[model samples]
Target: MALQLIPLPPALWTSLPGRSSVRTVADVIGSTQPWRPISLTPDLTLNTLLSLLPPAAILVGIASIAREDRMRLLSVILVGGGVSVVIGLVQITSRDLYFFRITNPGYPVGVFANRNHQAALVACMLPMLGVFAGLRQGARAGAKLQAAFAAVAAIALLPFVLANGSRAGLGLAIAGLAAGLILYAGHQGAWSSLTRSRAWRLSAGAAALAGVVLVGAAALYSRNDAITRISSATTAEDQRFQFIPQMTHMTADFFPVGSGFGSFDSVFRSYEPSEALLRTYFNHAHNDALELAIEAGAFGFIVLTVLLGWWATRAAHYWRDMSRDSSARRFGRLGSVVIGILFVASLVDYPLRTPLLGCIFFVAACWMHLEPTGRTQKTD
Candidate 1:
C-alpha cells in the first residue's frame, strides 16, 4: 500500500495577512514622522517598524496565554526585569561614551550601549534552535522534512552570529549543544548507544575524522606567520577582572532596589575608580543576575527567583512525564538545554535584556509549557 502523509495545520502564519499592498502602505505610514505645521523628515524606517512586530506579537500572545495558565505572575516579573534594564540603558546616555556604541560593530543595542547585549540575544535563540530541532524529530515524515528545511535556514543564518565575535555566545552555543547531547543520551537509555548504532556510529566516526582534519588545517594556518600576526593584531586586554570588582561593589551599594531599571551606567560612572584599568565604559554589569538585582532591586531578585523556580518545576514535571513519551522526552531535553544555556550565559553576558532574545526565550518557554497530546509507545 502507498503511504499518505497529512500536512500540519498552519496556525500563526496563516492568520497573518499576506505581504500585499496593504502592508506596504501601513509600513510607509508607520515610518512617516508628522508635524502639526512644519513637517519634519521621517526618521523611522521600514526595517525598524518590522522589527517591532515580533515583540508586539509575543506580548499579545503571552498576555492571551497568561489569562489561563496562571503564568501571568511570571510574565509580570520578566516584564519588570525588562523594564528595569531599559531604564538603566536610558539613564546612561552620553555622547563620547554612549551606551549604544561599546560593543562589537553591527550589533543593535536598543537601550544597551554594549555588543554583549546583542550577543546575549543571539545566544538565547541558539537553544531555541535546538528545541525546534527536537520538536521536529517527533513530527510526521513530511513535517520532519519541513523542519529540516527550517534547520538549514537556521544554520545558514549562523554566519551572522559568528560575525558578532561574541566569545560568550560561542561558549553558550557549545554548552547548549553539549547539554542537548547529554539529554539525548539520557533519553535514549544508553550513553553507548549513541555510538553503537550502525547509522549513528558511522556518522559519529565520520564527524570525528572531519574534526581531526579541521584541527590539522587550523594548526597549519596558525603556523603561517601572516595568519598568526593577523589573529594577534586585534587582541584586547583582559579588563573584566578589574571592572568586575567595581561592579560588585556598586551592586552592594544598591542591593535592594537597584539604582532603578537601566541605571547601571549612571551608577557605574559615579562609583567607578579613577585608577581606570579598563578603557571602555561598562554598560551592563556583565553578570545578568547582578545586573537584574542592581536595576530591579529586591523586587527584581524576588521576581527572578520565582520565575526560575517555576521553570524548574515545569522542567522537572516534564522530565518525569517524558519517561514514557519520546516526544515529551525530546521537549524535555530541549528545555533542559535552554535552561542550561541561560544559566551559563547569564554568568558572562546579558542576552535576556535584548528584546529580540527576550521574546524568543518567552515564546520557547510557552512552547515548552504546552502539554503533549500523543500516547507513549513502549520501546521494549
Candidate 2:
C-alpha cells in the first residue's frame, strides 16, 4: 500500500509553496538533490518509508511464529510496557533519565519522544495484562504465579496511568481497565460466581475507591502537574479545530490524487490560514485521519474505509460466543480492542506516527488474525 505512488511521474508531485529565508544554507543545498522532485519532499517520504519498516517487520515476523511462541511474545510486550511505566515514573523525578534526546524533557515520556505516545502505549497494555493473565494458562511452570503477578501489576500501574496527565490517555486507560475486567471475568467463567457473592462486590467497590484515592494522593503529595493539565481548558478550537477548514481546502486542491505521502508539512504551508500562524509550525496535521486525507487524497480515505470495514467484520466474528477454550479468539478480541484505542487516540493526536506505538498497533492487528494451531505449528 505504501509503495503505490513510487512509479508515478515526477511532475505529478505537488510543488512547494515557496522557499523560506529561514531555511538554513544546508536546507537550500539539500533541496537541490536529484530526487527532490520525486514527491512533495522525497527526503521526508524516504524517512516515512524508513519509519514504516520496524512495524512491518514486527507484524510479519510475529505472525510467522508458533502459537505458543506468539503467546510468549505477547507476555514480553506486557513486561516491556511495565518497564516503560517504571522508567516514566523515574523520569518524573530525574530529568536526565530519558533515552531519547528530543523527548518531553522533565516529563514522563518513558522510551518515547512524546508523553502522549507513552501514555497511549501504557493504556493499551493495561487490558492486555489482564487478558494474558486470564487466558495464558498453558502447561507452563508458575501459571498461577503469572496470574497473580499480572493482577498486582495492573493495580500498581493504574495510579501511574491516572497521573500521566493526557486526557485521551486517562480516558482510554479507564476504558481499557473496564474491558480488561470484563475479559478477565469472561475467561475465568467467574461472572456468575462473582455476581452472586456480596463480598466480591464489596471488594470491587473498595478497590475502585482505593484507586481514586491513590490518584488523588499521588497528585497532592508530589504537587504533580498532571491534575492541573488534565483539568486545564484546551485550545483545540484555536488550533486543531481551526485547521480543519484549511485542511479540507488543501485536501480538495489535490482531490483524487494527494500531494503525496509525507507532503503535509510542505503542502500545508500553502493553505495555512493567517489566523493559525504563530511562532510554531505544524509538522503534522495532529489528526492522523485528516493528514492521511491530505497526503494520500481520496484514495487513502477509500482504503481506510475498506480496512475499517474489514476490521469490524473480523471483530464481530471473533467476539461472538467467546469462551475459555477459544484462546485464539480471545487474543484476537484483545487485539481488536487495542486497535480501537489507537484509532480513537489518532483523532486528536498522532499517536500512531511514533515508531513504538505504530509497531504496537500493527502487532495488535496481527494478533487479531491468529488461528489456533492445535500444537501442529512449526517453530519459527
Candidate 3:
C-alpha cells in the first residue's frame, strides 16, 4: 500500500520564508541564511574534542579490570565493529545512495566512511583484541587463540584491503607486522642476554639472514607478469612523490597557523593541479609526518614528538621492570606488540585520525608504561 504524506501545520509553514516552495522537510533543512550565527560548541573544535577523548578512554580502560568488565569492553568494540561492517555492506549494496564514489565498491570499510580508514581501524583493533584473548588464557592457549584470530582477521581483511587497492594500507600492514615481531621479541627478553650467549647471537644472526632472504624472494616473485600488473595497479609511489613538492609549497604558504584542521584538501588542490594520470582528490598528504606538519605546523609537530618520546621512555622503563613478574611480562609483550604496529602504521596511513583506534593505542601505550613492582595491582 502507498503511504500518504502528512502536511505541515500552517503556522510552521508560515515561519519559514520560502515554505510554500519547499516540497519536503529536507528542503527546509537544506536552506541556508547569511544572517545565521555560528555556534561555538566544544565538539565543534578539533583540539577540544581530541582532549576529551584520551582521558575518557583511559578511564574506561582502567575501569575494565574484572573479567566481566574486560568482556564488556570487548563486546562494545566488537558491536561497534560489526555495525561498521554492516554500514560498509550497505554502502556497497546501495551504490547510488551515497554521493561520494569513494565510499562505495565496499572494501572492508567496517563502520568507517573510508575504506582505508576502516582497514586501519580493523588492523589496530584486531591485534589488541587477539592479544587480550590470548593473555586471558595460559601462555600456550593465549598464543594459539591470538594466532587463530590474527590469521582470520588478516584473511578477512586482506581481500577488502585489496578491493580498496590501497598500497599504503598494504605497506603499513607489513610494516606493522614487522614492528610487532620486533617488540614481541624485545618483551620476551629474546635479545636481553644476547652478548652473553653464543646461541642467542647465532639465532639472531640466522633470523636476520632469513628475513633478508624472504624479502628478496618476495621481491623476485612479485616481478612476474600477473604480479607486475597487480603491483602497477596498486602502486602509489608516483602520486606520493608528486605530493611532496605540493606539500612543501603548501607548507611554505601556510607556515605558522595551518589552513586549519579540515582545510588541507581545499588548500592543496588550489596550490597544485592534478596530473593527467593521477586525477584523484587527496584528503591527506599520504605521509603522516607531512600531513601533521602541514595541518598543525611546527608547534603541533613538536608537541606530538615530545608526547611520543615520553611514551617511548615509559614503555622502555616498564619493559625493563618486567623481569620479576610473569603477568607484567605478558602485558608488556602484548602492549609493546600493539604499540609497535600502530607506530609503524602511522608512518604511512592516518589511522590516528580515527577516534576508536587512536584511543585504544593511546590507552594501551599508557598501560604498557606502568611499572609492575613485585605485587600485581588490580587494574580495571
RMSD of each: 18.0, 6.3, 11.4
CA shift of 28, model 2, Å: 18
Q: What does candidate 3's lDDT look like per residue over 1-380, in tens digits?
A: 00001233444333433223322444568753222111111122345345557757666766656533433444465557656655665655665334355563534465555656665655455444444444433357666776566546544543444444455555444444344343334434454544535534544564464345334444644322322434575335556566677788766655554434544665566667645224567767767767666655665578779967876776666545432334454455555655666666676566666666776665555456444545533222
Look at candidate 2 and give me any clashing residue pairs: none
Give the TM-scores of the predictions, in the order they appear. Answer: 0.55, 0.80, 0.61
Question: Distance from true position, residue 204, model 1, in Å?
Answer: 14
Candidate 1 ranges with C-alpha deviation above 4 Å: 1-59, 63-103, 106-127, 130-144, 147-163, 179-237, 277-279, 320-322, 326-329, 372-374, 377-380
Q: Rank the candidates by lDDT, best first.
A: 2, 3, 1
Error of 3 at 89 (Å): 7.9
lDDT of 1 by residue, 1-380 (tens): 00001121334212222212323554577753211110001122223234557767886776685433423233343344345334434433432333453443333333455545544544444444434444333337974774575356344334333443456654454454344343433444444333335535643554454334333444544222222433564423444445677777765655553444555665677667787626667666767787777655566689889978888887776655433545444554455556656666777666665665666566556646656546664221
What's the residue-level lDDT of 128 in candidate 2? 92
Q: Rate the local accuracy (lDDT) of all candidates.
A: 0.49, 0.70, 0.51
Give lDDT for model 2.
Answer: 0.70
What digit string (tens of lDDT, one per residue) describes model 2 on residues 158-268? 667655767667767766776677666556654434433553564466447544654565565554355666567566744767788888887776666666678788878
TM-score of 1: 0.55
Structure candidate 3, residue pairs in collision: 62-380, 64-380, 65-380, 84-110, 84-111, 134-142
